[model samples]
Target: MDTTAAVPPATVIPHPSTAQGATPVRHNLVSLRRLFWLRWALLGGQAALLVSCEAVAGVILPYSPLLAIFSLQALFNLLTGLRLRQHTGRGARPGDAELMGQLMVDLTALSAILFFTGGATNPFVSFYLPGLAIAAAILPWRHVVALAFYALACYSLMLIEYVPLNLHNPDNAINYHLAGMWLNFVASATMIAVFVSRLSGVLRQRDAELNLAREQLLRDARVEALNDQAAAVAHEIGTPLATLAVIAGELRADAADPRLGATRVSAYLPDLQTMEQQLELCKSILARLRDDHETAAPQRIDAWLDGYVERWQLRHPHARLEANAIGDAAGLPVEAARVGQILTILLDNAARSQLAAGHEQIPLRLAISLDDHGTPPTLTFRVTDRGLGIPPAQRARLGEAPMASMHGGQGIGVYLAQSAAQQMGGRLAWHDHHEGGTVAELRLPAPAPEPLPAAPPPASPLTTNPR
Candidate 1:
């Protein structure tokens, strides 16, 4: 069957347009608030540092004019904090470009203050490099370049003004100091530029990969939903097709006057049988599909498996069935229907494979057990058959791969069986049996159930009133 044609196309809403109107107000508010808090914390830290520096300088170096500069930086931090709060309160977020521009403006003002305090000769001038690094991290390439140029211009102006002045030194030490400062600034700027650019590129690549994975996941979900719908439709038509087959057979036998020739009736009989078989196949497919989503209240694993084996034996009367509990599986609790379906699929597959191979007598063996290594236990089911072992090439594609070419003339029974096993948080894997033929094993997590309370004793019956 062409599953795509049987199922309708799924309507997908893109992530950006999932919310109609209202501008995604909640998300925008959250994003803005998060940014506001981050910026406020950073600015608050900067303010504290400036205030501490100002206090220390005022006490130790009372005559030094740099104390005023530190105070001015502290005031600027306080103002930036207030602006951030206001922006957050209004539910407004500054665009990336605007934020970068503001960072550049703040860095430039700091650089100017540092130059005025001690020019290139002051150790505090080294602090300017950190601001430049921050700018590189947050700003676009063109903006970073523009900021770098502005810093260079300001440094040059400070050097020109300080070199001629003999405020601290008699000799012209400012020239040598200016050259060293310029080299440090250039080196820091280069390093920051390289680091930030590489980091941004890595983030962009990771985002692209995540987006591709999400899209692929959505597409797979749509395809699976389509398959489920097709299975349902096939199941619904099965009974009617079976009825038609019965009627066709009766007509073939009763037509004795030769209104329809024997050859024509014979040709129609095979087609009728084929249709009936197709209907049965459809019913099986639908059952497997339903089993994929089945969940049942927890029950003892051994009892479930034993009961299932008994039911399957009735269905395949000619097959010899052998079932055994290997370990503590009898007491293990599990979702009975899902576990039963998985066992049924495995046993049915083994039986059918044996019949297809023309085995004189079909032998189906099943083993149920548990593996308890640590806190959680694992339930295991192993089904072995004395049939033609799956060919090496075909065994490789038994799980999720399409089995059209592997099955040759047969339909998709094996594929659906494998799918049902996996949907139950288990796996179906085929291997050669010890003596011969094939064995498929399924493993699932043991269900954990809370202990039930003991029941109360029943009371004696009361006398009934006269009618």
Candidate 2:
């Protein structure tokens, strides 16, 4: 089923900084590399246009100085490429200042070319705008403003003094100027759209990655806090649990004595046994805090779920759980305890919902199926309940944070379950069941075929087996 709900904000992490302006803007090496190639294209175009105007269109210009400026631009481009190639360290990147410097060099070169051809009257004088637009996109506003003023000053200086293009016929000046203006517009528009759009896309991708990192940090912090709280709670309950265990043992000893009536002793024995079992369960859970979770051996999904359901049934005697494991998946390398914990949370929520809706008679069902259609086949544990469906507004925000539920629940379990799912490289999502009520589904990536260890050599018939 498709999950359309947006991920909720990270609310557990405290004191998140929201001041975006405090961070400095720096362009990545990709931008600089692209700008390098783009400069080559512009240089080629300038050369082609210059040759066409002088030879084909019969417009006189100073070839020597123009070629010298062109050579200088090419040399600078070569140096930029060398700089990029030489710098291969982790911090090797074009910063805002370096990029602005490159743009400034291009503008100065353009101004020099224009001074020889037609000064401010040159049609390509407006080319400054495209570069300025790119600067605004990648650099900070201060750099953009400074570049703008510099270009304006250059243009003003050009207007006061320059060589004009000498045409074969003075009457053709208006026609040539109009044609050049059209070409300038086309070139300027292309440059602005191509370069600025590319830079914008990179900026957007960077922002998305930043948000992902921030959310991950928040999740880690919340998980750490929860773990600390759990440890402290476990420590606090240890003494009380030990005291109850001693009291239960004394009651059992008293029940065994003939002084107590046989009928009363028999009746109290079952309750005492149940109390002892629960106490043992609590002690075992507390002991698990020190167990190395990473060393847990892989087991069959069906086998794991069967044992988990039996243990869960002990804790929840009233609510019925019907678990079904489908598919022939072998050796699922998952953290069974964590998965069981998440399922416990889901099952508890389902039972609460059922009780709230007065449908305690209906059994909550969990179907574990292996989806082999996709790469790295997925194991889905879908828990369905015959209870009231979650409200549309609340459904979207269900696992985002702890919220009050109409079913007398704090909703902390669901939030913790979702976080645990994420930690295990899985996801938990809920949708309305087709018939009624809600279905909470957990999908985990299942990599299969953990090979069995090779069998040891058999002992001789006369010798004893070492196994």
Candidate 3:
């Protein structure tokens, strides 16, 4: 036994993206199933009517051939049911052509049955109106029109060629069928107005809903694809980052040797440390890119600000990194990783601006404060730098990733920083300082604090230890 061949299709599961793509095909099969059941009902009704006319009413024509026609219809319905059953488990759907073919078979079988008894003279001849109405509800417009025309042809042919069952004289028969025709016309109108209107409207609505769902799935798939690409890029860059880190560490160690002149050590040690810092930062960033889902514990507002400035300074040794706490923020909660990331971006940008302007040392000021005016207190950071001022035109596009700058580089860093800040319920903005350089401000709502502990008892004089 070949194992590959033995594997059942029932065991296979398609991805959500693939399953969504196959929806339209499934819709077709659904249409076929609906049509099949309706056809079955038609077959059942035909059998019952034939029996009543032949046995109870004692009206007969050619019983054997008519029964054979009914048998053929039953057989066809059975085969269709079996075919649908086979596909049901496999989640397969029928196509438009298949559904159309099924509809045409039903109409033809109906036409033949009508021809046997009375054709156009049969009061049930108006039943074709219902069939046409149903076709309009379920089938495509072209198929609907085709089925309608076909129905017209069948009725016309029956008027000329169908066998007559003389149950009544001309006057009685005309009155009876005319009444039926009027009643059928009412039923047809009701079907079009009430049933078809409700059913077809819902079908169209569902189609539109499916289309929207597909579009959302497409967007999700594209985002997943982008994430995969990012992972590949992270893998490619990991090696270079490791190599740089090792080299920077070695350079830092070498710079420590007193064998080199004191002046030379002093001259290169900061540069080496800065290089190591940058390399470590690169490694950290790559690791983050590899896994962006790590959870970071909350940190105290002051502590996080202090630690961030310390690390951020390593990247820009000549740029001043200071945290001046201006607001009462003793117990404010802060998301350590998120806050660090946003500040890192702001500090880096300021340093770059100064360096690009050929400044040996970049002046950066970080002012931390609380905006007491807001309902819930907000933590604020104001970063100021003296560098080549941004062009007036560049202000609006400051944090736009794909923006072009006078200094040639993609503004990806600023854009990411701004986005991160906004996500944290903070805002990032840049403005040309009145005196010089740019001031970037970020404001975030401080997390609600836990209840304060009861005040500790003051130490008694007797309990105090004497030095």
Candidate 1: residue pairs that collide: none
Q: On residues 1-467, what C-alpha lDDT tens digit does candidate 3 reach at each position?
A: 00000000011223544646556555565666766776666667667766775454444656776788888888888999998987787877766666667777877887887787777777768777777777776678998888888888888888899977656345466665666577557756754666466666667766786767767767776566446435433532443455456666766676576765255556666556656666775565456444544424666655455546665564444566545655466446666656665666666667667677766364577777777788777788787877787777777767654465556656655665666676667777888878778888888887776554422332221121111
Clashing pairs in 3: 29-94
- The candidate, 2 or 3, that scores higher on lDDT is 2
Q: Each model's TM-score, in the order given?
A: 0.42, 0.51, 0.47
- The lDDT of each candidate is 0.55, 0.72, 0.63
Please state every model's RMSD to the true fold in angstroms.
16.2, 15.7, 15.0
- Please report how far candidate 2 places residue 278 from its true position, in Å: 12
Q: How would the candidate models be sorted by lDDT, starting from the highest?
A: 2, 3, 1
What is the per-residue lDDT of model 1 for residues 1-467, given as tens digits with 9 covering 90 to 100? 11111111222434522322223333333333333343444445444544553343321222234455555655655665676676667866555565555555556655655555456655445655655665565556787787788777777677656422223333545553565466557645654555455545654655565566567667866666656556534633443455566667866665654755555556567656655555554555456445534433566654455455554554454577777666456555766554565565566667666776677275677777778884567777888887777777777776565455322424254455456666666677889977777888888776664353322321121111111
Single out the weakest 10-residue window by summed lDDT for candidate 1. 458-467
Model 3 regions more than 4 Å off: 1-18, 51-65, 89-91, 136-146, 182-216, 232-247, 255-258, 261-265, 269-467
Candidate 3 weakest ten by summed lDDT:
1-10
Candidate 2: regions farther than 4 A off? 1-27, 87-91, 218-222, 248-467
Error of 3 at 13 (Å): 19
**Winner of 1 and 3 under TM-score:** 3
